[model samples]
Target: MTSEEEGLRFPILIGDVGGTNARFAIVDSPDSEAGEPRIVRTAEFATIDEAIAGSILRDAPVLPNSAVIAVAGPVDGDAIALTNCPWVVRPKGMFNSLGLSDVVVLNDFEAQALAVIALGVEHMEKIGGGTPETDAARVVLGPGTGLGVAGLIYSRGRWIPVPGEGGHMDIGPRSPRDFEIFPHLEPIEGRISGEQILCGRGLVSSYRAVAAADGKTPRFTTPAEITAAALECTDAVAEEALAFFVTCLGRTAGDLALVFKSQGGVFLTGGIAQKIVPALRESRFRAAFEDKAPHSQMMAGMPVYVITHPLAALAGLAAYARKPDQFGVATRGRRWRA
Candidate 1:
């Protein structure tokens, strides 16, 4: 164990809360491994309190002294609300309700950024041929219920996370096929954004758009159905939709890499990426990622991988909870500590 983890108090509660699920775990001490995470479907609970009380805390061996929660939204103000879920996470309220002394909330992608350093080759599947620069910036972004983006910069012997709402950025067509499908998306979303074509909802939207472009009617209403059909080659429109989705994801990922100059690498995570790994391996994804002129060579040299860890965000939150100063994460909520 590192010296940074030596000073943390025992029984820390950590969580990775997203639109679709809430995963929680407990670490007996900073130096000890976090326990197996208990996952709860977000739709089953009306509030964060109910989910926590009914799941992770229900059969706990001991009460936690502190907590760190990685939430899927911006975490700047006093009011912490999830972008896609109805739950609102208030630090002070949680402190009082859970009877915890300290609580720290982090943006979900920020947690992902922190987890990048802890990830090993075993946890990653390479998407392209490139070596990661040890000291440069690394980016992590992927589509799930929504698109999440974050960057990690190495400085002063530590990694700092940079979080932002990158998924909402406007996205445009890059290829002839993309152009053909663009008009169809405009009707679903007035102005197409990265999230419009790269997320779960986006997957369904892509199927509808591709079906219309192919002069056929869509039979799949959910992303899961479309993905299954596409993978099985049971529906031509679904296959086309999946291809389009992968290409758009690659284009957006490349854009993020350029913006962050992530020579260290780009790591893809989230539910959608994992489920569509086969589709992402197709040529279109890599081709689109390296399509930028004059910088195509530079882009090719940047390593890309898909993160396969199930509890990466939770582990990241635990890491930050152990040493907030090392990560440069603001521990404002710790002020509530008794």
Candidate 2:
């Protein structure tokens, strides 16, 4: 390696910017080159730019020109807008403001998908299906405040991330209970995306619907509380709600796998999926995932991985930074240049 690459400084600034919070890290060089990055602190800042600016000032004498940001938004040339956050991340603006030369912007889920390609069995919790194959196409979905979806295709001996607004797609009811609650939820139906029933807030909505069905007034609770109650088997309504949620997730994952021909596997990420692993294993998720018209065996053979790594997205950012050439731009084939 040349001195430019070899002498590249340690503690590169990396960030995983989400709607609610932005996680900043000072990573040492890649494992092959240097020691594992010791996190200075996973500082929480109010906005994406602020978090990044703060991390930069605190970690090094000056900010590095090249930065890869994993943002929960759509990447459009020089302009990027987050789906959930109000921050508008523009590469040109950041460049002019920070006096940087290169900035890499990628869809958050797309970044996650990239990281999934590098993830090993130890980094994941397998819920069902057989072993994962290297050549197979894979799907990565995360349910948080919103549902994020991305497709990973094997091409040129590397995984390519194709991010889409899969969460905004129409959500269909699969069971009688779902149908029964449909009219009551009509106020939110057309306006509601898959995020309505597939995210943290969606858990609250699910619990409310089930509570109403049981002839009990609906009570509000956070997703964490709901999951805890269901796990302990103390709340039958919560359990039922969670069961339905898992089934829906499975059905949707199956649909995505079929659509993308994700023979590689399906990876479940996000805060909610990690917490509800036990319930998901016990629910009808696997059965629902495999319950297709004529491709039941195909879904059954597909491996499902639940991402357990805390810095999975950051790992993706690092991977992108290390090999930016592999990303090869978006579908339109637009290259990012100053």
lDDT of each: 0.83, 0.72
Count of steric clashes across candidates, in order:
0, 0
Runs of candidate 2 exceeding 4 Å displacement: 1-12, 26-46, 186-189, 326-338
Q: In candidate 2, how many Å is residue 304 off? A: 0.6
Q: Summarize candidate 2's per-residue lDDT along 1-338 as a digit string, tens digits.
A: 32222222333455677766666554455553212333322234444556566655455654565566677777776667777777777767665665555556667888789878656779899988887776788999988868999998877865688888898777777678888664444235357567788888888888887887667775547888888888899888888888878988998898999998887889999778999899778749999999997999988999888999877887776765655556533533222335
Which pairs of residues collide in model 2? none
What lDDT tens digits, residue by residue, belong to model 1 across residues 15-59?
889989899998887677888789999999988978887897889
RMSD of each: 2.7, 4.0
Candidate 2 — what's its lDDT?
A: 0.72
